[model samples]
Target: MQLTFDADVEEFRRKFVEFLDEHMPAPGDVTERSKSSAHVPDWARRWQRLMFEHGWLLPGNPPEFGGRNATVLQQYVHLEELSKRRIYHSFNPQGLGIIAASILSFGTDEQKQRWAVPILRAEITAALGMSEPGAGSDLAGLRTRAVRAGAEYVVDGQKVWTSGAHDADVLLTFVRTDPTAPKHRGISVLLIPTDTPGVTRRPFPSVCSPDDLDFNEVYFEGARVPVANRIGPENGGWQVANGSLGHERTLLWLSFADRLEDLLGDFRPRTELDRDAYARLVMDSYALRMLGSGALAAAARGEQDTAALSILKVLGSEASQAASERALDAVGIEGLTHPAVTAPPPPLNIEHFSASWFERYLRSFAGTIAGGTSEIQRNIIAQRVLGLPRS
Candidate 1:
């Protein structure tokens, strides 16, 4: 019932703030470079190396694996602080958030040695290839096939929306390996090297923007991956994928909650958000924070409520939409003209927030669709939370 940071977490925040103040790039540095620079891998690597050296890259990773072995509370503090300052290593999410943690839990020690440290150091980049053009939200319907052949599996299929596939070194992909089993039961996950002979990647225009945040269409024609690369047993990948999604714990998707608080806190009288509007923002923000905290508390104690995750997704998505509307109203027409609205928001650039208001609005709209659609979330609440009949 009592949701608050302990003293240790507060101390960690103070130290983290100091580190950022001293070593973090100046806001303008990102803006200037992004305006003229090409997609330079070295730039991202250099920045990631700096954070890694400071043991700040993945605070939750074990110390031996380049993490601080931070407590859950500490991790929450770090993320919240980073959100407040608008500081985060945007490139590491697919790797650190999903892949590395997965390896830590499911991979052999040898596999961990091969992948974990380099990933934490940001020396390697990875992508998630779970969504196919035909199989998105309905993951079980995936058609990408990986058939066992001697010590390797021959893969053949196409994946769409493979973010960063063009440059990523590897992909954590789910492929169908058994047609006889039921849909969810027939899939398996693999760590595939993109440089394999039969692999081809073609860039696609981002649904959001063309400048950055690009997704790709990746083709696999008899791509051979060692059997050692499989994450879980053949036809048993559903549990692995579901476990990973559950690990996200809803908080990851609700990052908008913190942003909403920031936007609402910065609101002024001239921006056209009425006093009532501001008050509603305050109330909604507080309510979300409490609900999210309770969900986390339940999760940490091993009594996670599926309905809470569904509720958080729905409320959080709606909250983000509401907050975006208010932020645009606060900045008046200026927000509409911001750079993210005009083009891709500059990576790591905090100064060019001009188009970010609108860009964020566009991006956050996906919050409803990404993890699960709002309609799907409602169905989950109806059946799982409300105990309703399917018919």
Candidate 2:
């Protein structure tokens, strides 16, 4: 089936393109890159704030939350255009996409005003503190503990792989509030300020690049967070965590699709083997885009097919990894010596796979592991979609 938008949505896209042409930042204005995924530079912050002011930051939310209550189709078009252009709505993606979305989904009116508004407006940033040293894929295995004492909860534990924690203003942290209870039942989430007396963050470099210091290990040594900071009911954090992960996985395929499309557009095969690989990647990218469109259509109809989301996640991420690898392979050893390695980094907002094939290939590994590993996603698809028993 051919995908097309109605007249109003087309008009919306036209207007959005015009807006970008009028206000998009010049390349020189955002030349410096922190090389970290989580840090937002001055120009990015200003760009996000400007979009918020114009109600383009989140077109589905109310004006106070930087939206015009645009239709679902309009929001889809908006995101599509931004991804096609490799523009970042927020430099702190986890803060805007996952944290703010979770707060809006489950937070009280007071909490929404206190936390989500500033996030959408780019006034302050947030990070998710779920993965601990002991807990990576299995969140129920986490060991961090927070005990209640009068009006505060004294927290003590270590969280690893807490991306952007070093630069974030706050962390949506998960802790075990009732260890005696079953593993999943007594979990809870807290909005802990990163600057609390007992909180510490140590950033570590990743394999993607020596300059790309994005991952952090956070320590909480008797950190005292007010009991009022708890999100949702105590011992009900599993539900909140599920909501956050669901939001995180739902639309992430769009970025992978955009990247694959970009790679496919620029590919020029040098040999018979290269042509065969390029053809396979093209078909895979086409299938992924079609699946994404179908998922979006279902969402617009208010039908939640979670199994479809799992399939999209698996296909989109793996396809992107394959495409990046192919791009690097096609270049042979010379790919390793691209100028991006020695040159000052390209502006984060405008650069895509074209930035550096080597860097892109290294960074692609995180895509499989980030939201959930490919192994976990396959198990989900097997059990939920294929009617197979859990192994």
The candidate scoring highest on TM-score is 2
Q: Candidate 2: misplaced stretches above 4 Å? A: 339-356
CA lDDT of 199 in candidate 1?
90
Please write out the lDDT profile of model 1 over residues 1-391, one tens digit for every residue. Answer: 5657779888988888898788876545554332211132455557767877777776777667755877767777777777766665545566767777777777788878787667767777777788888988889999999999999999999998876778778888899999889898999999998898899988767545557645788999999999999886778788878776765544664585866665676555463446666777778888888888887677666676888888888887788777777666666676655543344444564324544666666766777776677887899899997899988
- Cα deviation at 320, candidate 2, in Å, is 1.0
TM-score of 1: 0.85
Every model's TM-score? 0.85, 0.94
| Poorest 10 consecutive residues by lDDT, candidate 2 | 339-348
Candidate 1 residues lying further than 4 Å off, grouped into runs, are 1-3, 26-43, 265-278, 300-302, 326-352, 356-358
Candidate 2: count of backbone clashes, pairs at least 3 residues apart or interchain: 0
Worst 10 residues of 1 by lDDT: 31-40
